[model samples]
Structures are given as structure tokens and as C-alpha cells.
Target: MALRTLFADPMLRMLVAAVLLAALLPARGEARDTAQLVANAAVFLLFLLNGLRIARRDVLAGLANWRFLLPLILFVFGAMALLGLGLNALSEPLLPPAIALGFLYLGALPSTVQSATSYASLGGGNLALSVVSAALLNIVGVFVTVPVFLLLGGSGQGAVGSAVIAKILLLLVLPFVIGQALQTAAHSFTARYRHNIVWVDRMAIAIAVYVAFSGAVEQGIWTRVAPQAWAALLGLVAVMLLLAHGGAWLTGGMLGLPRADRVSFLFAGAQKSAAVGAPLATILFAPEAAGFIVVPLLLYHLIQLVVAAPLASRLAQHPAGDGDCTAPTTTATDRSAPPR
Candidate 1:
């Protein structure tokens, strides 16, 4: 019953299982190369589905809330920046330099879409706001995160250039555009079939996680990370989540956002995107070091879900005050239908 309850969230079950599977029986030789290709294709398809589902009007509605949006963005990006810098300063003693860089990399990532909105909706937050905020952050993240990464990473200027941006455009942006165009062409079909269509994104994420973890295992990633470091990373993840949620709550109060809007702000601004982070890490870090860089992200992903699950349940008990949330949004009922 306990295990069943824990696995109730398909996202959590799949991600945790993928990591364990990769750790125990990593792909090798030709299989490894093949897996990487599959992961890449899956990522592209995932974004393509994203394009198909996200309505432009929803984004526009979110954009209208400039006062609420601006400070939220600053809190998400700026606060993470400060946290990453502090972690970087202290992590050298606790973690490998490359892994330390991973925490910084994790900090620079955009907010999650599927998971964040799911939790926000569950928690009686402004689901539309969560969706739009997540969409906007990712769109900007492709351009902004690279520079933030390079600036925070403080190394390998040559690693990031137009080529990396080109990859993001090709792999992430193009498919989304095609999907969006398709949505425009067939709005009814897209809406009717979204539940079925979301499998593509979920599969893509699973494959990507498998491939990333497999590669890391092959590179002795587990051997390099001591038990203490793992414990520290876990603790750090908890602390980060707490600080992010608390900070967002406080910011929302200061901005005088309504309860529902505050809930959206807290949930959406606090979570990071593992889906985008995995593929981007492959491009940014050395192949051998990529796994270590992903470690913090993986931990962050799992920890957020664990922390937010009960919080969402608790928040749901309160009455969600209606405010100015008019945009169409996703909810837990359509788990497999939205892009993350």
C-alpha cells in the first residue's frame, strides 16, 4: 500500500525507476550510442507536442499581468543565481568541481511545465498562470540560461557559442513551432487527442533520463560521488526547495497577489525543469562529466515532487480565491496531455 501510494504519481515512479534501471544495467557499446540517438529524437518529439498543446492566448493573458510576472521572474532567476553562487563557494569541499558546477547548472534551468502546473492546479493555484509562466520561462530560458550558465560556470567560453544556440533552435524550438502550427491547423483534433498525444513527451523524458544516467554510470559517476556527498546533495535540495517556496510566498504577499495567484507564483517559480536540463547538459558539459552535472538536477526533480505532493494536498483544503486568472490552463486531470 505504501509503495502503491508513492507510485501514484506516474512521473515520480517512472523517473525513480529509470535512474535505478540505468544504475543497475547501463547500456554499452553500440547500444549506448543508439540510446543517445533515441533520447535526442524523443526530446525533439516532446517539444513538438508542447507546441501542439500550448495556446497562444493563454500566454498573452499571462503577459498582461506584468506587475505580478516581473518580480516573479526576478525571484526565479535572480534568487537562483544568488543561491547557485553561494553553493558554488561552499561545494568545492563537499563535491567534485564538475558536480559542483552541476548544481549551478541546475540553478540556471527554467521552471517545469507539466509537473509545476499539475501541482499548482492540485494546490488550488492559478493553473493558467502556472502554464503561461512556465511556457514563457522556457522560451526565454533557451537564450538566457546559456549566458547565465557561462557566466556562473566561469569556464570554457568555447563550449558555448552560436553552435549550441543553433542546436536549441533546431532540436527544441523547431519542433514546437511545427506542433503549434499543427494546432492552429487542427485545433479540435489537437484538443480531442491531447491525452493520447502526451505519451510521446513522457516516453521522450524516460528515454532521455535512461540515456543520461547510463552514460554517467559508464563514466564512473557513482564511484566519484561519495555517500556523504549524496547526503549533502539531498540536504541541499531540501533547503533549496524550502527557500524557494518560502521566498516566493513572501514575495507574493509583498506584491499583494491573491491566494490563487500566490499559489501559482510559489509553485511555478520554485520548480526547475529536468526535461530541458538533461539534453542541454549533454551539449554544455564534457560527456564524462555530464552525469555528475545532472545529479543535482535529478535530485532537485525528485525532491520537489516529494515536497510538493503533500503541500498541494494541504493547500487544496483552503478555498482558492478567484482573481484575474482567465487563461485556459492544465490540471491534474489531464496529466499526460500537457508539455513539461
Candidate 2:
């Protein structure tokens, strides 16, 4: 039954298919160049859609809830990054250099806007706050993740030069700004067709993964990484997952937040965005390097989805009080378009 539920997820299936495809037939020579171009364009479209879909008022509202937002930002970027660094140190002897660095990259990322919000809603959390907080974290992550990763020694894979910085601004930040500027004109279109457009996000991520893994295959990832290293990597990722979710929940309780708000914090603080992580990796590292760097993130993403479903179900069944049952009003737009 649990296996059925896990396989039922289309995103998980797609991601698995992507990894298998990359291993079986990796792009090389000119094909690799073409694939990279397509991946970049897909990333641009993904973030542009994010800008068009997310409501401006929600950003303002989320920012005003500093009590929630400040703590969440710190937890996601600060504590989590440190946790990743600590784990990376432990993983160095067990895994390859690039793959070990993946832990730090994973921690530096933002929360998933779609899955986090979806789970928060399922768990009977403050849906409005969930939407705003997750979206805001992604927004902040676009700017902050690189610096945080670099500061924490992620640059050991490759230096983030000015050219890469320009690409980041052009490929990511500019598209989002343009989309936001055009949002007023496209609001109805975005709201009406959001579910369909979410495929853009998924496709972009899959393309990034495919491109990245293709490079890894080309560089002999299969032979370089031993079977025992794979086991160690999985064990390390599991530990990180436990810490992320457990720590977030405990911190929320410490903050004295209502149960609903605590649920929101749990998902928002714990979840990491492959939407942001995958595309950014392509720009940051060579394809060969990126494939290894994103291995931890890919595993973490799949595991989190599997864990969130049952955890959400349990939370729903055992609501703490009136606070857990209350549903705050949110814009239709906020609920409609969530970045995966």
C-alpha cells in the first residue's frame, strides 16, 4: 500500500526515469552543448512562471509576518547550511569529493513552494501562511543560496566566476523580474491555467537532472563511485532528513506558535527546492561536476515526498487544538500556482 502511494507520484516517476535515461544514453560532444542550452531556457521559463503566478500581496503579507518569516529564513539557510557542512565533513571519507559536497549544496537551498504548501494544507496547517512562507523562501533562495554555498566551501567544486554570476542574474533573476512586471497583464491566464503550467517547473527540473547526470555518466560516475559509497550516501541523507524535519518541528514548538503555524514552519523550514537547486547547479558547475553535486539533493527530494505524505496524514488525524483546525483566508492565486 505504501509502495503504491509512492509510485503513484508522477514527479517521482519522471525523476527516476530521467536518471535511468541519463545512465543509458548520455549526451556528448555537440549534443551536450545543445542539451545545456535547452536546460537553461527551461530554467528561465520556470522562474518566469514563478514570478507571474505568485501574487505580490502575498509577498508583502509574508514579509510582515517577521515572527514566522525571520525564524524560517534562519532555519532554512542558517542552521540547515551548517548542518549540511557538518554532514559533508563526515561524508568526505565515505563518498567522492563532489558528491560529498552535495550535502552542503542541499542544505543551502530554499523550500519547495508546491509540495511544502500541499503537505501543509493536507496536515491542516495555516494554508495561507504556508503558501506565503514557502514562496518567499524560494524568492530569497535565488539570491542567497549561491553566497551561502560559496561561503560554506561549496566553491571547492568550481569557482563561481563573474561569467557564472552574470548567467545567474540573466537566467534566473531577470526572468523573474520580467514575469513580475508582466503579472498584472497575465494574472487571469496564470490563475486559470496554473495546474497545466506546473509541468514547466517539472520539465525544467528533469531537463537539468538529465543534463547533469549525462555528464556524470560521461565522466565514469558508475565506476568512480563504489557500491559501499552509495550505501553511505543513503544513510547520510536519511540522517539529514531526520534532523531537518525533527529540528524544524521542535523549533516551532519552542517558538510557542499555534499548532497550525507550527505545521507550516515544519514543512517550509525542512523542505528543500530542487526547482531552484537543479537549475542553479547547471550554472554553477560543469555538467560532470553538477551530476555528482545534485545526487544528494535528488535523493533528499524523493525521500521527503515519501515521508511527508504519511506524516501529513498523521498530523491530520491528531490535531492538537482549535488552532490546528483553523483555516486562514488566502488569495485564490496563492492556492492556484505553486512551484514544485
Candidate 3:
């Protein structure tokens, strides 16, 4: 049926498997401590492996297109800041100042591989561009995103400190650099072990989810967050997702971007990267707040998968003779297909 198989993506499947493992066979008492370590290692290795898969050339090329990417990055940043301000003003206080701040965090998050490619493939956006864009977003987020979080993640934690920055450098940037260096040194090994390593990414995320959730659970974090807060958080998540998707679609038409590029923008721009955000949040925020900060990210992850899959399918099934998003942005390249 050419339908998207949830199991086709070994990482997604592994994540599902890990979640089921946690839910169905949750660690208890003495087993809980060891389980936590495994989960944390899993999360670390995920990014380590994600870095290993990217082609250095594509990341470099995406950098070359700064004219396109820079503006988009700025636009996202500005929109997030503005939304935070506006949402902060609501007298209902449905949105605490922290939420507005959290929105900015989610807004500043890096892009993902699967969803971006899937949607770029849908609307005929640039595959190479999508690849590069996603990579650059992740790379930049490692440095700037966390520092910004420290500076602006609000008083829930004071200004993000230099030591905090150092941790990010250690955990994320340093390991990613080491991974890239290793990949360059052992291209053939990486290629050979790619399938085995794919599971690493999923296991990593599940480990992250468990560790983050567990830490919060241990501290009785949910009891602190009101039921109304959960409702508000869900509402805010919905509005932001709608805005991201709708805004991307509208901008594609208004900017007159080629259909393929629009697809790239829609998928790449709209979705938040949990793989990147989870590790960063755990390291930066208070253990109790990690759950709150990460709730949006996790929601964003699920939403992207649920929303984008069908959305891509519908876009792909465009009616005959309809004006296609097949137009090229630079050369005659077909952005919809995998780059030849």
C-alpha cells in the first residue's frame, strides 16, 4: 500500500519499544537506579549517532545558503519572543511567565531528520536543503540555544550561568564533535554499523524520557503542577503547533517559495526536535522543571509524527493536473525525490 509503516523507522520503532518497556515493565525500587543509568546513556548515544549519520558535505552546503536560512531562523526567534510577550499578558494567567519562556525554548529548538525529509518529500521541497537545514539547526542549537535558555528561560532559574554553558559544551558540542571526527576517520565503519547504530538513537530518546520523567516523579513534580496548568500547557501546545504549520503554509505562498521548499519549510520549520531539546533541558533546568520544560518538547514530537504523516500523505496525493510544488529553487533539481 506504500503506507508509512511505523516499524519502518527502526528508531521510531525502538522508541515505541522502549516506551512500552517502561510502561509495561517499569523499573521499581533497587532496579530503578540501574534502569535510570541505562536510559541516560541511551539518550546520550542517540545524538552521538545522529551526528554520525549526517554527510559533512551537506551540512557545509547548508551553511553556504545562509541567505535563506538566516532569515528563517531570525523569523522563528522573533516570533517566539513576541508570542511569549503576548501570552504573558493574558490576565487569566493561563500562561505563566515560565510558559511564555518555555514557548521560546521550544521555538528555539533544533529540527529533526525524519519529519523534515518526510514532508520535504511530500511538497517537493529541497531534499539537500532539508538535510542541510536540519543539520545546521541542530548544530547551532547546541551552542546558541542553551545559552539563550540560560539568559531567557526566565527566573524559574536565574540567568543561565557560565558553568551551565560549560556543561552544554561538554555534553552536547564536545561529544557531537568527537562523533563527527570519528565518523570522518572511520567512514566505512560508520557505513557498516549504520543499522546497529540506528537503534542507539531511539534507545537514547527513551532513556532520556525515562530519566527526565523519573527525576520529576521522584520529586513529586506532578503534584506541584496544577491540573489547570496541564490544561493550559496543552492548549498552548495546540496553538503553537497550529501557528507553526499554518504560518509555514501561508508563508510558502506569500514568499512564492517553490512548492518543494515550502514542504521543507513546513516540516522543518514547524516541528521541534526532542532529541536535541531533551538532553539540553535535563542539563540546564532544575530537575523538577525538566519535566515541565520537556512536556512541550515531547508533545511536539508526538504531534509532528501524528500530524505530519497524514498531512504528507494528503499532499502527496495531490490531484492530477494540479499545479505542483515541483518547481526548483536554484537549478533543475527535483526537490521532492532523494537527491541524485
Candidate 4:
């Protein structure tokens, strides 16, 4: 039963399998180039599909929930960034500077679209607000994050940030817009086959993860950091997530938000975008250091999944009062499972 549950989530299994595959057969020589090409293509398709999956109704509804939306957005971009900078500063003497910088980058990223909204739905939250806020952040984050990184004195500063932004426009944003445009033409087909797209999304992300870990492996990523450093990174991420979630809950309470909106706020405000973060790290950071920088984001992504799944489940078990956005009649499923 334990093993069955462990393998229940296809995405989680794929993630673990990808890491192991990278460890055993890290890409080299010509294969590395091919892998890069595949990863890039996968990312483009992933975003495009994401675009197609989004609905205009969600955006309009999200606008209506501005009170909840605004605070969550501020938390994602502003508070998280500042908190990371401060933590990095305080821990500078103890941890590697790269790891510190990694935390900062992680904080600066936008909230995830699919995962945040999915978890929100699962937790009996305001799905419309969650989806809308998440979509808006990704769109804005493309422009905002790089400049913020520069302001924080991130390495490769202007030049690297510029390259990342350009790539974001061409690869990420454009495909998404194109997908959105094609949605109307493909509506019937997409509606029929929407469920299948989820696997494609999972596969694309898994491919990206494999290529990233392979690059890191080639750079001797495992050799560079000690076990103690790994533990420290984990602890720091846990604290940050806890603080972010607590703040979101408190902020929603102060604003007199409904239970559903508060649930949406917690997930949206606390979650970071691994989908964007992982690919962007490759372009922004040097090859040798990209893996280390990605460590925090990767770990945090997995940790959030583990932590959110149970909480969402628990939250769903409770009843919502008046004015609460009814959790979608269809349940949201966890795409990933924790390692056994």
C-alpha cells in the first residue's frame, strides 16, 4: 500500500526518475546539445498549452477579486524578495554566496499558475482568483523579475538579465499568446482532449528537469555542496514557506476575506514558479553555477507540493460559509507525490 501510494502521482514519480536518470546517465558531448534542444522545445510547448488552458472568464473574475488579488501579488513579488535578501544577508557568513543568491532569485519569481490554482481548487479556495492572479503574475513577472534581479545586484546583471528577458519574450510569452489565440480555433478539440494535455505538461516539465539535473551533474553539482549545506537549504525553505503562508492567512483575516479567498491567498502568495524559474536559471547563470542556484527553487517546489497536498485535503474537508467561492465541483488532483 505504501509503495502503491508512493507511485500514485505520475508527476512525482517522473521527477524522481528524472533525477535518477540524470545521476546514472548525465548527458555529454553531442547528446548534451540535443538534450538542450529538446528541453527548449518542451518548455515552449508547455507554456503554449498553459495559455490554451486559461479562460478569459477567470481573468475577469480575478479582477473582481482585486482586494484578495492585490495583496497576494504584493506578497509574491515584494515581500518574498525582501525577505530573501534579508535572509541571504544574515546567513552570508554561514552559507555559500551562490546559495544565498539562489534564495533571492527563488523569491523574485512569480507565483505558479497551474499548481497554485489547482491546489487552491483542492483546498476549497477561490479558483478564479487563484488562476487569474497566477496568470497575471507570470505575464508581469517576465518584465519585473529581471530588473529586480539587477537591482539586487545579481551576477551577469544587465547582460544576462537582458538575454533572459529576450528568451522569455520569444520562447515563453509569445508561445503562450499564440496558444491563447489558437484556443478559439481549437476549442472543440481541446475540450475533448484537455485531460491528455496534462500528461504532456508533466512530460515536458520532466524533460526540462532531466536536462537541468544533467547539466548540474556535469558541473559537479553534487561534489560542490556538503550534506550540512543541503540541510540548511531545506530548513530555510521550510521557514520561508511557513512565514509566507502565515502572513497570507493573517492578511486575509485582516481584510475580512472569505475562507475560500483566504485559501487562494495562502497558496498563491506562498508558491513560486518553478516552471519559469528552472529554464530561466540556465540562461541567466553560468553553467557551473546554474545547478546550485536552481537547488533552492527545485527543493522549494517539491516541498510546497508535499506540504500543500495535505493541507489542501484537510481544508477541503471543512465547510465554507456564505460568500465563499465554492470549490470547483470537480476535484483537483495532486500531480506529484513525495518520495517514499
Per-residue lDDT tens digits of candidate 4, residues 151-261? 776664223746666776877888888988887787887789888987887888777777777877897767776788778878888888777677766676666788887
Residue 282 displacement in candidate 3 (angstroms): 1.3
| Tens-digit lDDT string for candidate 1 (256-325) | 7888888888787889988788876765655566667788888888777666666676667645444433
Give the Å shift of residue 171 in candidate 1: 0.5
Please give each candidate's TM-score: 0.87, 0.93, 0.79, 0.85
Give Cα distance to truth, residue 10, candidate 3, Å.
Answer: 5.9
Residue lDDT tens for model 3, 107-186: 76767766677567765567878878877877877776655544553545423577766766666777777778787776
lDDT against the true structure, per candidate, is 0.74, 0.88, 0.62, 0.74
Which 10-residue span in candidate 4 carries the lowest summed lDDT? Answer: 327-336
Candidate 2 lDDT, 183-222, residue by residue in tens? 9999999989888897777888899999998988999999
lDDT of 2 at 331: 28
Whose TM-score is greatest here? 2
Candidates 2 and 3: which is better by lDDT? Answer: 2
Q: Count the backbone clashes (under 3 Å) in each candidate.
A: 0, 0, 7, 0
Cα deviation at 282, candidate 1, in Å, is: 2.8
* Cα shift from native, residue 8, model 2 (Å): 2.2
Model 3 residue 295 lDDT score:
62
List runs of model 4 lying over 4 Å from the truth: 1-7, 156-161, 316-340
* Model 4's TM-score against the true structure: 0.85
